[model samples]
Target chain A: MELFPEKYSQAIEKALERYYERYTAPENLYSPARYILSLGGKRIRPSLVLMAAESFGVPLEKATDAAIAIEVFHNFSLVHDDIMDRAPLRRGHETVHMKWNGNTAILSGDVMMIQAYELFESYPKDIFRDVVHTFNRVARLVCEGQQMDMDFEKEEYVPMEQYIRMIEMKTAVLLGGALAIGAIIGGASTTDVKKMYDFGRCIGLAYQLTDDYLDTFGCEKTFGKRIGGDILEAKKTFLYITAFDNTTDKGALRDAFSITDEEEKITAVRTLYRKAEADKAIEKSIAYYTDKALSCADSMPFPAHVRDTYRRLAVSLVERKV
Target chain B: MELFPEKYSQAIEKALERYYERYTAPENLYSPARYILSLGGKRIRPSLVLMAAESFGVPLEKATDAAIAIEVFHNFSLVHDDIMDRAPLRRGHETVHMKWNGNTAILSGDVMMIQAYELFESYPKDIFRDVVHTFNRVARLVCEGQQMDMDFEKEEYVPMEQYIRMIEMKTAVLLGGALAIGAIIGGASTTDVKKMYDFGRCIGLAYQLTDDYLDTFGCEKTFGKRIGGDILEAKKTFLYITAFDNTTDKGALRDAFSITDEEEKITAVRTLYRKAEADKAIEKSIAYYTDKALSCADSMPFPAHVRDTYRRLAVSLVERKV
Candidate 1:
């Protein structure tokens, strides 16, 4: 089954297309914001917004603003994060800071943050406060996650639970927040809204873990980004932490990371990860979360067809046998 | 007379003091946010919030959250701006990025932005949307202003009008927006709220012009910050732009600015500024705007004593013999 019954997907895409035409002055402040949206991703979060809203009979018009707002908010985080990481590229093009100066990126990103709330003005006034409160909580969590991600760099080890918490905050909470907001706006009951939120969040966790798996093991052409790129950066990702924590030869693993040759370093780290069964462990964890994610939908009080749509989304994200 | 007979000031200070006790983990984010607030400035913006609200008959208890929220958002912008400007200090102490790294500053600043809205949770439900919508607009304007400030750096000569426009966006709008919000929350009529906002904005413009005047002319001891500092940095302030625009001897002005000796440069620039009568002209402009600002209050439909409190604020800010 598809994410929704039908045409709402196209309606959302059209809404997003209309959103980019908003023009603000001092082109440097607004052009990057427009440009990033043009370099589109799958639009999964927004589509999920529409899906949740539609499932509860909320009109596509009611959800379009939120769909655009969440997408814009996502781009805001990317623009700022690119500057902090000093990354030269994003989505196979020059990052905001790389194309402009850091100051431009910072200022532009700041505007984008405010503009997201501006878009939220389209939300129905009755539940507007709830959506804003949820957004505030999620936005704060995302910032905290980023701090923890940076903090992990200085450490030899981050406990698996803390690592999981970091990823949930950094990557999953926005996804969950998007779904919950959509369901609430669609007039779903409290019980249904909570289930949708938990379902979205669990799937989001699985999504990140799968991304971790693909970075190390997926086909180079299929991945559409560089394979083994994180390893080259000495990034303390889930794979690195899990493998390091499981290994008996911790000192050797530390010294291996310092290897000067990029190819040799990737090779050595891959071997260590395999020996520690880190890849298997991560794959198993992804499966577990994916199952939990799908099960969250199974008991929802919604119609069987609406529940089926959720199961299909979870299966597509997990890419496992249903 | 003194922005609420002085007791509201104490109430606001106490509310702000209690605000810092919010505990968030990892200390890196919350601690710096607390530290910046502790390095207190005049608390003018928050005081204006409470002052405007009280002028409309709202009590201190009814307005403290907004007072605290505006102050926190102000510091959030400062923390991020210091990073963008790569400045080492603020309020006579090390900047957040200087004390921590750039990443910490960025993350902490991001959290503060979200937390500002979180503080608005205390607003009465009847007025919450009004407060949030106003905040969203002002926050975006502040970003636009910062962008304009940076953009002005690239140009050899900025028009006097454009310079004023930038400072109005960068500095004045937030003050105005704060007042407008406070008035709205305190049950002021729509017409009176607009007048309050315009009154606050005109005074904000005057406030910035006075700041520009003080940089070149005020006593360093009384200014409580370095004087001659803008001249040293080649920061084209209102004085510089006015002097350059009006001077028949433009080339000499340019050469004077290229002076390598810091002491001699300030001396030369001050002489040129005097020749152009930029100081006297700017003072005239300040006086004119001050009159316009205070007049905005005189026409308010409220009682006379409430009007006088505003008059006193205007005089204190303009600091001219009435």
Candidate 2:
């Protein structure tokens, strides 16, 4: 089965476009929101929301608004994170802060976050409360995760367990939250909803780990981004942190990260990553998470074909070159 | 009756302090939130929430969480707005962005916003959805208002109607929302809740207009801020906007605004304002809103004492020397 079929993407895009039509005034505030939404991401989290709703036998319309909310929220986070990171580009376009200004970006992102919550109001009262509560928890966790990520940048040491927890909170919980919201709206059983959340969490972990892996090892032709960008920045990805644990000579690994030349730094870091077998460790971790997601799918109430489709999604995500 | 009784203020302060104690981790994220909350303001909005609940015959405990939510959200906006406005001090203390940093302020503000929403979960399901929907709308309007305020700083012209709408959105709506949320949770009739909202809104307009008036004309010792500060900043306040409209020699007024010396500019602007009768106009508008608020309070379905209390509250807000 195809992963993230065109039908799903087109439906999401149409709904999002329709939702944003009401915000034409205050161009400075809403334009950045529209610009970021139009930048065409994979929409993976929203797709998980849709897929979970469908697997629970709900109509597409029942979950579309929640999906849009998740997408809008993700974009909101991206806009603010870009401002915080001082990033000039996103999806090969100027970020909101770069295009307009930081204040515009901040305020626009804030409005987008509120709009995301407003979208959830279409559900029934009980469902709305549950979904909002779930969203609130996940949103707070994402902020906490971001704080931890920023803190890690300045800290000299981060435990491996703490690093894993950081990735879980930063990226994985939102994926879990997306699925849980869809399932709850679909009237799924509590146990089944838990299973769906766990499934998304596992897949999210694998997806982020694979992304870290591909930054250094992806095929240049298919990766779409320049490989080794993370290496040049000395980002403490799974490879870097684990390599410190696995390498016999930690000083050499640190020296490799400290290389001045970009190309030389990438090569040296990749070599150290291999020598320390952190690459293999990360690959094993990725497989572990993917398998965990598959088991979660198997335990869920979805039928054989739906389970097969979910399995295909996990494989496709981890297998992506870009 | 006192506008905001000491008992109500103490209750709100204790509730807010208890609410913030749970957020100890990620010091960078929670500390700013705590810091801003600790710099106690009048707690007027939360007091409105508690007042509405009590007037509606609901237990104060039933509304304390929502009151805290409003207070937290108010501080969240302040933290972000201070960054955007480059404000150095708030309540005579260093702004969050100054005390910590811009990134910390941004992220901490974001978390505080999410926490505000979470506080509403203590309500029942239907009331939770209603209160959240109201909060969402008011919150978005506040952002739009801030955007318009910023835009006005750059633009040469703004209609008086648009300026009123801006102030309504920027400050009035949240006060209205506080009352609306409390009334909703208290099971007040829809019409009564709306009256409560309108009362807060009228008083809010009067309060903000009074603030602008005091900025130029208030006694420095009582106001706790420097007089004529708005003139120095050339803020497009009600007085400035009206003076521009009412003055015959617009060129002289413009030249007066461009005066290099701070004292001279204030004196010139004040003279121009009096010449155009703009100060009288502003006073008239303030009285209009105050009367409107009193009428709203009288129309609400409450005892004579409650209505009398509301009348006194509106009067005190508009009649304050500071």
Candidate 3:
């Protein structure tokens, strides 16, 4: 039932531990980076990087640096994003900006980014160029996505396509870029690299849509938190946008949004979402993206087992409650 | 009076203008970058990039992207640094964070850093890798230097050597890196590139020392701000550190630093600086570094005029009132 090779996950954890051991100086600037990294996530992106590289005939050892680089860059984005979001907690601990001050968080995050680029220097000339080129493009897109997310906060309505685009840029592209970097480092052909990127991107979209779905529809215990947290915040998530688009009782939807009591607001919005079939809409979109990911994986010039692994990864990422 | 070719500046301006025109989307993200760029600087770093490339026999046009990259990186640092420093003005305009908000400044600065790396993609694979390598090293050092500076603010005493190292990393290495990158792109020999980096580093040290000196001694009108601004802020500049190291009357120096009134603090600190002969100490350091820069320039593989132009640049940058 493991989604990826368990050994890949173990290797990644060891590599990250070795990598973070060097960040000891200037505690104010580097400690936050180390701290944030230590607060573990699923390590899915780095796992994808290793799996892609291995699938392309490169050993996990050869691609370890790129895997670490992707993970580091991802954490760098989180450190800064947490500051911008005014987020107090990450992974049940104080965020970087909360642990240190915002200024420390910003400076530390800046160094983390440079460190990510430095990780790519171990590669030879052509691979280094391609890897960094992909990094720069994806990094810029991530920033744009963050800006768009922030912009959406003040707006009354955000169209479904635009919201998807924002999430795609903000979240999906990095996943794609991570796979592409690993593939390039593994010496995959251009077509295979592109397909790997497409595969990761489709998986990322499906994963994010599932995240939205779980925020409302998931079991509180299984999801590890209360459901409808997004509704309480009146977030214009996929279900919110879809419901607004399809609901015949627009006034009731608006009134539901204006409800004063948090529990009542969550209940009313969930009811409206079900009535408009936004939950079904989100489920279909998730399936659509998941299918696209499988097709991309199937088209890759990998063995049948490798394709099956990717299929399982896509399924596990989207089908989970948490 | 022109230390560099007039056409180089003109070309740099045009190149920057053309480069910035493409940053139109997500007004909050790109506008701050554009706005920061629009507020003119001396263009010293970019000009160094072009001048170094040209000195190595590359055409000015060949180095425009690198030149712009260095400048953009500089501004990106400023945008983030201003946010950290809580400064309201940059080049007499509202700082990015002040004009918009801290979140915008942080995000915009993040994108700008990525954009700097993106500019390197146009080079051939080897050259691109080399240039980006130099950039990544310098960028990390710059962050470390900034952290050191912030660390110094809390300490009662900072060693003069550490202060110099901090400034060297924070301010000088970028200049050196910029020159080195240009030299690399222009096909300079490894020795020549090292010499170019040394020359720029020496000049940067001298220039920064002169900056510390002018903060207490220069005419307000010419310096474009009130003299002793560093003293007023109790900044541990070269003068402050050296004065504390050399001053016999430690109590009086401490008393001078603790003076509550603004003008009194300035006057007391300046008197202590002169008494310690820190003014003389700083001037000597500036002369020493400037001479070292000239020696470096003289040893480079260049024509007499090229060497002479570098000497003039060193003298002009370090010996200026502003």
Q: How far is each candidate from the true structure, as Cα RMSD in Å? A: 2.4, 1.1, 1.1
Off by over 4 Å in 1: A1-9, A320-322, B1-6, B320-322
- Taking chain A of candidate 3, what TM-score results? 0.98
Instruction: List DockQ for all candidates.
Output: 0.75, 0.90, 0.91
Off by over 4 Å in 2: none
Give the per-residue lDDT digits (tens) of candidate 3, residues A1-322.
6667788888888888888786777878888888998898888888888988888888898888889888998999999999988888998899999988999999999999999999889999988988888888888999999999999999889999999999999999988988898899889888888998999899999988998999999998888777988887777899999999997788999999899988889998899999999999999999999999999988988789878888888889997877
TM-score, cand. 2 vs. native: 0.99
TM-score of 3: 0.98
Error at B65, model 3, angstroms: 0.5
User: Model 1, range B95-155, lDDT digits (tens) per residue?
Assistant: 9999998878877888888888888887766577888888898898889889888988888
Q: Per-residue lDDT of A278-307 in model 1, one digit per residue for the tens? A: 999998999888899879989776789878
* Residue B89 Cα positional deviation in candidate 1, in Å, after optimal superposition: 1.5
Compute each candidate's TM-score over C-alphas: 0.96, 0.99, 0.98
Candidate 2 per-residue lDDT over residues B66-108, each given as its tens digit: 9999999999999999999999999989999999999999999
Candidate 3, what DockQ?
Answer: 0.91
> What TM value does model 1 have?
0.96
Provide the TM-score of chain A alone for each candidate, in the order shown: 0.94, 0.98, 0.98
